[model samples]
Target: MKICFAVFSFLFFSSTSVFAEESVGISVTATVEGHSYSSGGGGAPVPVPVVSYVSFSGYAYPAAKVYIESDSQNVASLSAGVDGLFSYEVYGITAGVHDFSIYAQDLNGNYSQSVSFFVDVPSSAITNVSNVFVPPTISVDKAEYGIKDEIKFSGYSMPNSSVYVVVNSTDGSLKSFSKEVKSDRNGYFEYAPIANVFNYGAYLVTARTLYGGVFSSFGSSMDFQIMGRTSLFASRPRCSIKSDLNRDCKVNILDFFVELRWYKKPLNKEAKKRFDFNDDGQVDLADFSIMAFYWSR
Candidate 1:
């Protein structure tokens, strides 16, 4: 009986060893939609149209879990199919260089060596390469702001041309503020909106060139925020009640309109100082609550 038991154990150990040997390891290879940096692929930064999205595709071990990382942050993950293929799309990638890394891990927890590649999104200001005309560029002086502060929106365009500026909510649901400003001899222009033109929230500011009364496509936008008065002065009643964006001494639809114009976008330093109701550096629902509290008051 003992001899029979030893024979069974040996058979079991031999079968397990064969199964382990048959298991495949995880492997991954990836590339940007238009770039090729792989081995034997001439290392060149492929030029992609300056757009807001980028797609990545690659192969991994079948039935493996794949992870896509950007700037050391895991942006996305997916499961490899029977064909050992994976693809992912990243949205709102602004003009710049981005490094994306990918790796795979099999069900048995065996990980593949990470593969990485860089994608370049050229600036809209960089024209003349493909006969494609990119519009002018605009920028805010800072990222946040206070209630009664002046914001300097500046940019460059064709020399002595007319540039139109638009400040609106990032969500595209609010009334936008628009103005036409002229560039100088050097193609530089600046627009300083009236103090308190924006209310407690975030905003997207964009600029486009005007030729013979026709506006060109807007270039990339600048994001900024306006903070709530309560955030600026938590202990002072006089300042706490300063949510009156229209300065009519009351917060009403007019003020709400101001808030709507810039809601749900990023903020500048000065705007953030005013709109970050909770002083959290973000103009989120918490800050909106503060604005709602002063509604019609």
Candidate 2:
């Protein structure tokens, strides 16, 4: 009887070991509108009125319980299907970045490692698609300027509307500069610093139009550079389109007119160097193709 008991104990230990080895941990994968998440990726900046959806799907031990959370708030809890597949969706996320976490627990009470993702939501106050409000537009006099040099920043908005401007250094170290002014009778407004008063570096300027104390959710932004002694080595301002003649941050009919006016005209050395998108010694259809690629972008 003692020998029989010893044999039974050995068999029990071996079976327990086999059970532990067969129990695999869960695994998860997720996306926002079919795009996988990445740290600081910012996803695609979308206007606020559009609905954003996040979907989580993954494999777990068959019949396992899966729990998903957004910023630690439990958003979903469900059981994996017979094939070990589990899926869930969270909707109506508000403006700003949000964090999503998902994990699973098997029948054996083993918990899987949580998978996390980040999504960024841009501000948009428009609720009706048909009545979309067109925000004001802004522009800078030039792309690059010397430190302390006067730079004229201007834009168009609703007549008599208030415009708020915010300027910040791109290097991520300095405090932002801000000012408020009213649009003129013709819906035009301009702001120039009293003095350069800004550190020498790349800067981003954004402006929003305000009406009756409410401001546009997604304001317009532009980039410019403050040239320093070492600016030659610094990053240059990005030009989305070589044919943006008015520098209004777009290539549209205005640019087409500028190109038409200079079509086949004798090009100055600077104009040839800057406007010659094709590098074939002139601005022509070849350059127009490049501009068309970025139209309305």
- TM-score of each model, in listed order: 0.34, 0.37
Please identify model 1 stretches exceeding 4 Å from their true place.
1-131, 171-173, 212-214, 229-297
Top candidate, metric TM-score = 2
Per-residue lDDT tens digits for candidate 1, residues 129-235, read 11111245576765667777778888665456788888997666558988889877555678997437867677888876664343445655566776643233322
Question: Where does candidate 2 stray beyond 4 Å?
Answer: 1-131, 229-297
Per-residue CA lDDT of candidate 2, range 144-199, in tens? 77776677877654457777877888778669888898877555678998336787
What lDDT does the true structure give each of the candidates?
0.59, 0.60
Measured by lDDT, the strongest candidate is: 2
**Residue 204 lDDT (model 2):** 80
